[model samples]
Target: MLFSESIRIAVTALLSNKLRSILTMLGIIIGVGAVIVMISIGMGVRQNVTNSIASLGSNMIIVTPGSTNQGGVRSAAGSSQKLKLDDADAIKKKIKNIDYVAPTVNSSYQIVNGNMNWNSSVYGVTPEYLNIRDLTVSSGSFVTQSDLNSRNRVAVIGTTVATNLFDAANPVGKNIRINNQPYKVIGVLESKGQSSMGTDQDDMVLIPLTTAQERLLGITYIKSINIQVSSADKIDMVQQQIEELLRQRHHLVGDKEDDFTVRNLTSLMETMTSTTTMLTLFLGSIAAISLLVGGIGIMNIMMVSVTERTREIGIRKALGATFRNIMMQFLIESIVIGVIGGLLGIACGISISLIISKFTQFNTVLTAAPTIISFAFSVGIGLFFGIYPARKAARLDPIEALRYE
Candidate 1:
């Protein structure tokens, strides 16, 4: 028989038993759908992490106070008052390949603007903080050197704070009280959206570091120092230089643990990427188990199909149908089931992924590569599982098969 005739026969046979065929294809459909959804979610999570790190700024490094040991009880990181504004200045002056340095201290405070009141983080920082964090003033002017020098009570507010306090107002040249001390709002920052950790990036205020240390918080030490490198290639070098400089300044001799921690964003990004990639692979693997189970279902169903059609097979063989033709017929039937099921699974997976992204916080990403691969894998599953049943049907002795009842 011709190949097309075999395919026609196979399709006819499946159509004759529509319900059984659909039930047999169900496993493949579910397996393929699950795989696509899992992969999409994994990729989405990885992308979110990458974007979150990128939002911190390009070619950036952060310095913070390390843990301290007093009376053999180690305090939490950043609890020691070691990082200072002077240290920030020293790093800016001494370190090469540096673009900007922003030393900052932050505390939560209840901000009052007349009858309206809101709680938000208030950060004390220099003008460079804006450039370092890739933030721009959307309204009015940012803090100037004059503001730092005079310890002015001027502030820059984020978009979230502006909305809560000013309510669609420009917020510039307005007065807001922090801890009962009235301060002028000099600027409003553009929205930065939310971070991977679900932090609202646009929900805080910025003020001059000197003003915060001298008047507001009354603390001399800064909580953290953010540095922006001039180029990507120089980030590691600059980080090393800053670490050595800090160690020397703090008088840390050999084998002594430093009082500060230096971290480059590049290393952090790499670590996060590797971790997320592994997570994605793990999720994909777990979902692939369903495909294996689906393949087993196909084999079992094909075995039963061959048994039910024993008399028909004997008739065809006695009527001069070759073994190759009988085998091809069965194989084509299984492959058709897989192909149709795979297509349906792809559509279902994409639809569900889109629905999840629309309804939940999770961001789902769909790409062509995974979809194509999954479809191909389903087809392979069909071929592999169909082999045993197809061979068994083709090898049946015509005389005995005719008497199978």
Candidate 2:
């Protein structure tokens, strides 16, 4: 028989038992939908991570004090107070590829502006800190070199602090108290929603390094140093030079680890991306298991279909229907079920993904690749599972089939 004629016959037989056909295709529908949703979730998470890392800064490197080991006990990283302000100055004077370096120390404090008060992070920073952190002044100016040199009690506030302390009033030139000492607000930084680490960026205060060290915290060591490379290509070289120079300055000899940690944000981002990609593939693979289960369901139903139509098959054989024709007819029926189920599954997956994204914190991203792969996989499943049943039906003996009622 012609392929078109076989297809027409197969579709007609399936339509005659609409409910059964639908029930048989339920597995495929659920499997495809699940795969799509799972893959979308994985892709969305990966994208979020990438965006978060990008938001930190471009071509940035962070240096922090390393662990302290004394009397056979080693403390955690950043626990030691080995990083000095001189170290920051030395790196700046020596490093050629470095664009800006900002040495900083921070602590949380309750800020009071009249009766309105809020607890916020306070940082000791220089004018260069603004450029390294990509911070912009919405009003007034950032801490100047003169402010740092003279240890002036000037402050720059974030949007969160500004709103909580001053409300609708402009924060510039306003006086705010930190650690019970009055500080004049010199600038208000533009809002930076959140960091990759999930901390609110716009909830801190900035003061000159000299003022914070002498008048507030009263400590000599710095907590960390932030370095921005002049260009992307120079990040590795700059990081290496900084490490080597720091090691020499700290007087670390052979086999002795340095007392500081230098981190490259670019490398950190690449590592994060690789990890997320692996996670996405793993999720996709897990969801694909349902497709295999759905295929098995198709095979079982097709076998039952062949058994129920034994007498009809005998009649067709008696009427000069070739073995290939019988096999093709049954196979086409299975394929139709698969194709229809797959289309429905695609719709189901997309609708559910959209709903989850809208109603929940999860942001799902749908791509054409997963949808296409799922449909094709479902069709392939139908063909692979239908083969044995179609062959069994085509091989039945006409004489015996007719006598068996």
Candidate 3:
């Protein structure tokens, strides 16, 4: 029989048992859909992480106080008071290829504007903080040098803080009390959304370093310093220079550990992206197992089909059908089932990904590569699993098959 005839015969046979064919294809459909959905979710998570890190701005580096060792008990990073305003100033004055350096002292305070009160993160920083963070004032202006120089009681609020404090009214030029120490609101920052670590980036307030130290936190030491390098290539070099400078300033000997840590945000982005990619692969692998199960189902159903059609196979062989023709018929049936399942699975997977992204916090990205790969793999699965049953049908003795039942 011709190959086209074999396909016609195979399709006819599947159509004759429509319910069974549909049932057999169910596994493949579910397996393909699951794999696509899982991969899309993984890719989405990776993308979200990358975007969040990129949102921190280009060539950003953070310097925080390092651990302290006392009686062999070491403290966490930022436990020491080594990161100070002087460190930030020195970095700005001495470091080459540096754009901005902003020393920050962090504390939490209850902010009050008449009857409305909200607790927010208070950051004591200089005018350079806005530049280092890539933040802009939507209205009014950011903290000025004069504000820092004279320790003026002025504050800049983030979008979240602004909305919570003043509702729809403009917050700039208004006075809001910070820890009951009245401060003038100088500016409102644009929305920054959330950080990679899930912290609300737009729920804080900015104030002058001197004012925070003198009035609120009552500390001369800063929590961290934000540094923006001029170019991406200069991040490592600048980080090394900052470490060396801090070491010299802090008077660290050869054996003594430094009292500060410098973090490269670019390096962090690479690490996190790599991690998420691996996780995506792992999830894809797990989902692929379902394809194997689906293939096994196809094999099992094909075997049963071969047995039920043994007399038909015998009749075909007796009428001059070649063993290759007989095998091709069953093989085509299996491939058809797989191809149909794969196509349906693609639709289901994409739909599921869309639903997940729309309804949940999980980010989902559906791309062509995974869908194509899954479909191709499903076709391969059909070819691999169909072989044994097709060969069995082809190898049967015509006389014995006819005489059996």
81: Cα error in model 1, Å: 1.3
**lDDT tens digits, residue span 1-405, model 2:** 899999999899889888889988888999899999999998888888887877767899989997656667776777788899999999999999888999999999999999999999999999999888789999999999999999999999999999999889998998999999999999999998876445788999999998999899999999999998999999999999998989899998897877898999999989988998898889888988888888888899889889889999999999999999999999998899889989999999999999998998777899999999999999999999999999999999999878766
How many clashes show up per model? 0, 0, 0
For model 2, state the Cα shift of residue 96 in Å.
Answer: 1.9
The per-model lDDT (C-alpha) reads: 0.91, 0.91, 0.90
Tens-digit lDDT track of model 3 for 167-238:
999998899999888999989999878875468999999999989988888888998888999999989999
TM-score of 3: 0.96
Clashing pairs in 3: none
- Provide the lowest-lDDT 10-residue window in model 3: 190-199
RMSD of 3: 1.6
Q: How many clashes does the backbone of model 1 have?
A: 0
Estimated TM-score for each candidate: 0.96, 0.93, 0.96
